[model samples]
Target: MSHQLSDISHQTSDTRYQPSGVRNDAAPIGVFDSGYGGLTVLKELVKVLPQYDYLYLGDNGRAPYGNRSFETVYEYTLQCVQWFFEQGCSLVILACNTASAKALRSIQQNDLPRIAPDKRVLGVIRPTTEVIGEYSENGEIGILATKGTVNSGSYPIEIHKFFPEARVYQEACPMWVPIVENNEIDTPGADFFIKKNLHALFHKGPKVDAVLLACTHYPLLKDKIQEHLPIDVKLVSQGELVANSLADYLRRHPEMEQRCSKNGRQQFFTTDATEDFDNHGTLFFGAPVSSTHIVL
Candidate 1:
């Protein structure tokens, strides 16, 4: 169920240029997600990179990519990324786990350079795993994510590459996002699923010192998850760590960092109508979105 790429270092920049899907000259860093899950990552970005402009696209109409076919997810993600590029975004973030699993590399390899030379397309996976490697005391960690992310085995693979001795256990709470999306965080069923999954992770016998909320949507349920977990263990949210990672990356690559602006713009778009995306996204974004529906 997993495709392993041994030596991803070799997967780095290949000289051969191919046609990129789109191009643009916008000031915003475009962010795409299947739904509101990306807001967690975006919130962190705004906190860390407050002076920079941003453009967010949430694909709410065709959300919950976790249960969809891989090919479908890839195509849908590609469409959004292309749309962002057309909007003049220089960099894009694949903030959804399913998209990162199914489409990130193809965009990086076959699509990005052609679209915009050396332009960046960041993902939530590697930055998260890198943070996990940094904080894991005994090298035992747990990952709570969607079924697609768990199936991808991205956390384990990335962790093992850096910390071979680390023991990683993952639990796919397929219903968690729906519960969170529906604002059922306090519902009995929500608590039941949270308890059930936490117990399952406990039974895995990993002595988990840190738990990574691999899916960005998981941050919406952070309080509930923390309440269910033993206090000794720490919970890592993708948004927080990803924000720090992005700051570091910007420091290292000055060209990619946005120049200081007196007034930065934050643009939002959705493949679905603004009404649909706004209704659901506000909960995660902590504010109403000013999204325009695009033909992606």
Candidate 2:
């Protein structure tokens, strides 16, 4: 049988569902990442919108979506997003760069209407691109992301839309994910990869005034990235920017805002076992995520 938001709402109506940090009236916002990377986005969400409820789904079993075909990534992301909707999520956020590049549009256009009229889906790329244009001093900016994201040219496209004069340079750090997953963020080889990417960007031109960390996992290597940057180059991260954007978006869309519960809390799920998810997720979220597991 297919599940619906009404099913979850009716079950909780009789009982007081206490919202901890976020809005209490609406269902939780669904967040999806290929693996633990989305934790970077989650951390900011909890910090900036603490009053909203959140449901996080990490597709750990079939992660590294950066290498997958567009069709495969789209299908996989759609499945996860649909599952979140069934679990009573009024909004879904694609915290993965790869998914945002490959699947966000198709899901928003086709899947959201089928789930709920008020339902919405968001992605990380546009938010980052939008923010970069506002903050960049010069018309030039740099982006360090996964191979898929760079290949998609999402950053440059969004940047051009906002700042026609902007010059966007992209460099893909394909190995950073594995290093972060292994907790080797500060290892020598990690430094080498970080420096290599930074060099590639700087070599493009001195006009690059800001650098956006296009991958969620890139934040884990922020310090190393900073070390290799020019003193004038500003670093833009998606987590905080995306969180703030959501807050602004909600405020402007009162209908969506009013549906959100001010007393909501964060709930986590993983395609793999909860134990493994908790361990690795803790490393990513910077705190223990004691939540249930749901296999995808």
Candidate 3:
């Protein structure tokens, strides 16, 4: 299911943009995902912070990090983080839910201090959880994610930490990512799997007031998901929510904000062949992007 690009070097970028108002903060913010899904997160980020530079790295070659062991995901994520740091990123966000659930803490705790002491690595789960409490009026939320994320129990744990009255229920949609990645988003094939997962989640819990699209890839299935969900249940996606959370994080930590370069430029990198990444990436990002081939 994979192929190689002979001219991967053509995908890399040049860093000679004119300084906006530089004092020494010209590094781009790093966004890493297991694959193209994180572009949804980055798209929202561009809307909120169109002034800052961003570099996105998708490990498409070893994607669906959801099915891999925690140790494997941790090692892969660590390699990507180090690559971003080497590319001059002061702050890196692990935009994949599985990576965040299984690898983020270990990276922050063990890798950051030893590798890039001044850099920071954040995750989508924390940002998504920070505001979900406000969306749960019935004190019940359902999470639709990959098996790895569900097994990690990050959503339930973090949600309780923020809203104890709110209950969390989750259903692992292992097939959803493959469906979306294969460009079957709006097909009947996708609809069948989407409805089946939503039904499982609802049947497993009390009438949930809101359903959290726990994986970034799940957002592509949002419309189909809503079509099958009860009228009373609201579907929450992580893109805008995560964007707002990141904006707030930067505001609260001016030190980090000041360190981010604000030139409104974006660069993309992938562990897969450039041609394949570009073809699929445009579908996720809503625009055609020429990506550099990179290895971690």
Candidate 4:
């Protein structure tokens, strides 16, 4: 079911996804997100697999996929995945919960087989849930995510698959993404939404010993979230969890691992202004970043 190299329409010769270059196994791993948040995941990935090369794509111009409809998210995500395929990525990780919740399945089940079966696309939910139940001593965990993810019911479904006894309570923080993307996480303006969202989560269920930051963007509000929660509640961030899970996945699938190039190089791409991506990406990624401009 592997898509032939001829399948992708890499329109421009100057585009990074241009099909002219040799398509080989020693290609870069692709990391995608609706915006800069996924840079956090890429940061951890580089830490764990510094030897491998990575090409990250941030769809910032049309971001906040959390508010988009399922079909739109799926379509947009599929476009990015195809772009990665054109760039010769052997694997892709959707670092967006909204995209993962609404789009990953359709891409994996429907599109992959027809378009690029040989390439693998993984999501954050399963990896996060695989260990989430362990933190729920009371069998009840809280989920803080975007509206799309919360509406998708992905957390409860994935969590129950691993811990049937565990209860999942979700709160959709619609305003949080805007606040973080605006680089206002530390501002007083963010407190209202942060407190409001946490309050809603606590009211949704009994005392939740752990709260999963279901959206990658939420980690920027870690302190605010923690301050709003009980002292003992453990905050689970997906970057580290997903990174570890991916490391294990590569170990288990040697064929895929062997295909990844270990050049210790990293590349960043964005649909928005490259300067803006570098500025905000540096904030989320925890370092300086130089991103290239790309069209979908």
Best by TM-score: 3
How does residue 153 of candidate 3 score in lDDT? 92
lDDT of 2 by residue, 77-159 (tens): 99998898788777789999999999998888876777665788899988888768776887888889999999988889988
lDDT for each residue of candidate 4 in 1-296, tens digit (9 for 90 to 100)? 21112122222122222223333556878999999989888888877766567899999888879989999999999999999999989899999998999999999999999998799999988999999998878988999998889889999999999999998999998898889877788887899889888888888885889999998888889988888789989999999999889888977777777677655667889999999998898888886788899998
For model 1, the superposed segments whose C-alpha errors exceed 4 Å read: 1-26, 258-262
- Give lDDT tens digits, candidate 3, residues 135-237: 8788889999999999999999999898888889999999999998888987889988988888899888968989999998888888889899888888899
Query: What is the TM-score of candidate 3?
Result: 0.91
Off by over 4 Å in 2: 1-25
Q: Where does candidate 3 stray beyond 4 Å?
A: 1-22
Q: What is the lDDT of candidate 4?
A: 0.85
How many angstroms is residue 145 displaced in model 1 relative to the true structure, after the best TM-score fit?
Answer: 0.6
- Give, for candidate 3, the lowest lDDT window spanning 10 residues: 1-10
Per-model C-alpha RMSD:
9.7, 6.0, 5.7, 7.8
Candidate 1 vs 2: which has more lDDT? 2
Worst 10 residues of 2 by lDDT: 1-10
Total clashing pairs in model 2: 17
Which ten contiguous residues of candidate 4 have the minimum total lDDT?
A: 1-10
- How do the candidates rank by lDDT, highest first? 4, 3, 2, 1
